[model samples]
Target: MAREGQESPLLKVEGLAISHGDVPITLPLEIVVERGETIAIVGESGSGKSLTARAIVGILPPGINAKGAVTLDGVPLMRLAERELRTIRGSRVSMLMQDPFTMLNPLMRSGDHIDEMLRDRPEFASRAVRADEVKRRLAEVGIVDEDVARRMPFQLSGGMCQRVALAAALARDPELLIADEPSTALDVTTQAEIIKLLRRIQRERNMAVILITHNLRLAFSTCQRIYVLYAGSMLEVGDAAAVERQPFHPYTLGLLLSEPPVDIRVPRLVAIRGSVPRAADVIDSCGFADRCEWAKQICRAGKPSLAARDASRFTACIRQDEIQGELDALRSATLSATPETPRRGGTAGALVHVDALVKTFAGRRGRPICAIRDVSLHIMAGESVGLVGESGSGKTTIGRCLVGLETPTDGDIRINGIAAADFGAMAKADRDRVRRTIQMIFQDPYSTLNPKHSVGQALREALGASAGAPSPAPQERIASLLAEVGLSAAYATRRPASLSGGERQRVAIARALAVKPAILVCDEPVSALDVSVQAQVLNLFRRLQVEHELSYLFITHDLAVVRQIAERIYVLYLGEIVEEGPTERVISNPQHPYTRRLIESIVRSAIQRAP
Candidate 1:
């Protein structure tokens, strides 16, 4: 940490206010970051975490209003002209966005994009020197191969793309780095590697960093200080350890309580009730008052200013004193809920059985690249089976094959004793019946949903297909589906874009359940959601499995999530099942090296968290 009176802060913001269209999103806020310090802005979707980062980059979308003074090294950033800010953007301050695939130019070669940044500099007169520098930067981020750098953006995996983007951000050696959910989409091992890389770079460069994310564990592990944002307001600010040990605000407590336990026998996940309030609904009142269990009459009537709770902690809650006891109780409950014993039973009932599954894709050079080779596994009915792997490990390819979206090169997939190959060549009626027996939930809900259609239309379309026609009153079914997924009925008429990420995901779940399928192939379903929303979705999956006797082929990179729900787990590596056993046994006492690495990564992440 920087001394208080040593020098002026590296970055400072005061009286920051922002709006989207006609609604104010972020209220007047104050924050600062000193050289060699990292600050994490933690919040759920629509909490103004990403918006704040965008505001600093001067890349906020149109119809957004910002009023604040953002200064860097004593120079006012908001006062600078557009051209001036452009000069400072890549050379002085750089941002690493959430999704690297969308951030990178798809048409450009990966190496050329980094070289382009160097070519723009007047000092880089030699092409060979720039090329060497690009390779060195890529190597610095753990990507040492020459072939990866030469490949196009689309040719790389999501993890590889993220590393390329990080290299691009470091091409200019910016003084400040803004990483926004940098590891959200990555597997546990990849996420650990990225976090380690960022920390190493920051230490070596002594660059100030602003880490924005909804994952409290990630933030606490990487950042020294954390700021909790709720409904556009800064609810609390303090040292990460202090905040985690003794959260001062209701919202902060809610966030901490919402994380799912790593232990399998832990029953009853902690959930924060209600959704985040919209910007238009925010007023001069406690942002979390609506969902706060300890909210009082004063909490809803007036806003609370940040008050010093300790030497290093501050909170914006009128009932902080009264809530501390309840927060402590919740924390105790959370700790007690983690069980010492592991779950039993694995590889039974044969809900989904595959043999010699194979899928090959054409590489850039037109050579056949085997994605999955001779992969086989069995998932039991009413059982949760986890598919674990890093990117390019073919977990998703097998998932796609099981869902009938892609044809396997050679293999057999049996769901409920029905072979996938036989089901594929079956008549249209038989195929439709097989499809109705199994449904898939994709990773990107926003892309999966039709933008032009309302929730009702999407649900009705899916159910109508299974029902063979539209029901007499589809509205009630839509409402019931929403309720089944822990969403409000009022959301039935809303468009996909109009809903939060959690809400949109709930709608996706509802669409999958509309067919009354006995099996669900979830591909990273909760990876895009925050920890709170993730817990809710995990519990929902568990409940639906119990109620409907549904079997889940859950494919995810997050082992913590897998531990919570999966009865059995299959560890995939480079298109093969290297290890298979009960979830607890596979995760806790792994025999394969890859499985051991994954377990080590998860333990490292958890242990590195501020205590």
Candidate 2:
């Protein structure tokens, strides 16, 4: 399918299928990557994005098998032996995983990791030369700190660890790089820097790249082409700009609409209804039929084929043309709609107050590291206050201090007119009374919930520990709590591992609500979720706020998400509050330089995608 005078693709995937044991996980798929080109494979979690990448690299777990043809530079990889594949893995094609901290060896130094990759190469004839190359590679990835070479993985920051990982991946100067969710763990500013560095390296080396991610907007910003996948099937493929401007498949359009725009604020984000179907449940029909609003009976009659819409576009939907028209109308209606005016709250006295709060930790060689300075803030009853900052900016530290996870070094914290310091000194009943009034929801809900307990058991345990007077039976109360978070009572029988990311978060919220807390401290609750799932959770938060009249301390690095949920915003940098004001005012006219820099890193592709 090459044009005249064009070279064959650097990588070609034809009729590629993956299976575990006897059950097939992915259908036959095709992908092509030209030399020096960047393409994106985008979808939500469990869409086979990661599995496909693993299959291509011959790294699937035991019992999983990959079939069909995959070629790099006209060399077939399907029939290659394990020893042969090892020879081609790092020298010709390299991969970077999602979490660098976990991927890297904690015992080894940063420079040592890269040195090991180059140890087998003949180009570096001496240790001195290899040492110099290690520094050069680190500098190539924007890590200029010479001391990073000697420090362990835990000693480095998240950004620095990721840069080291990138340096190691490029040790052999591979022809192709596979970066899987590269920036999902870093803050906004660090993510932008990493992506910029990646593009620069790809261009300098003329290497091809396959970016796999759950974020469509992120993929569009860095890639020339995008392939949208859903329920283990490829749904759409097109030029990045073409897909952004006019996505053909209903699922693709839904993904585009789910993204929260940084340039403008909306009353509610457009969410795709329903969760992705489980792999076992996917039938020989449209994978998105359950969630597609315009689906007809024909959609479920048989599986649709990927048909060409134009020279550069293909979609797996029989109703693409019809759905495109409906999408255009919806965009028009959204553009013409009046913006909703948000109500300002916090007229009552402060329900939670911290004065001269300070927290410090022991650093290397016993030096003191101040996590938070003499920072002070308050939240009034029934108000949502956002705490915005980068990873090491002390946002999580403050949240922990507020919820009794960590005792403050120096400060005064009062909850509902009671001194937080007196909690330990008070009677067990009194301490429970004050603690039950406030609850904290962590970033990973699965980690917080006990995996062995069913959802009903978890909720029952929480209800049993309540200090307040009980009025309902345990089962009845559990059902009510689940329903409050938009979940059915049947979910109570399922364990945490059986639920999706969004579903687990909903269960976590229900558990937090079991004690009838007046305030909730949510810490980056939706950062790792898909856009559609994130919107659903955000909407659930809004509804819960109104129904329970609960105050919220929403902490996140995403400005768009904060603007949607928080009434007032506090921008934190280096353990200090740089700016604080109404969400609109602060985001529109940031006074602090740090706040402005944070805003600049936000990707505004959602607004730019439309006219």
Candidate of highest TM-score: 2
lDDT of 1 by residue, 108-165 (tens): 9999879988887877769988888888989999998989878999888888899999
Model 2 lDDT-worst window of ten = 333-342
TM-score of each: 0.93, 0.98
Model 2: CA > 4 A from native: 1-5, 335-337, 426-430, 606-611
All models: lDDT? 0.83, 0.88
RMSD, one per candidate, in order: 2.7, 1.5
The segments of candidate 1 whose C-alpha lies over 4 angstroms from its true place after superposition are 1-3, 120-122, 338-349, 364-366, 467-473, 603-611
Assess the local accuracy of residue 225 in candidate 1 as a C-alpha lDDT between 0 and 100: 94
lDDT score, candidate 2: 0.88
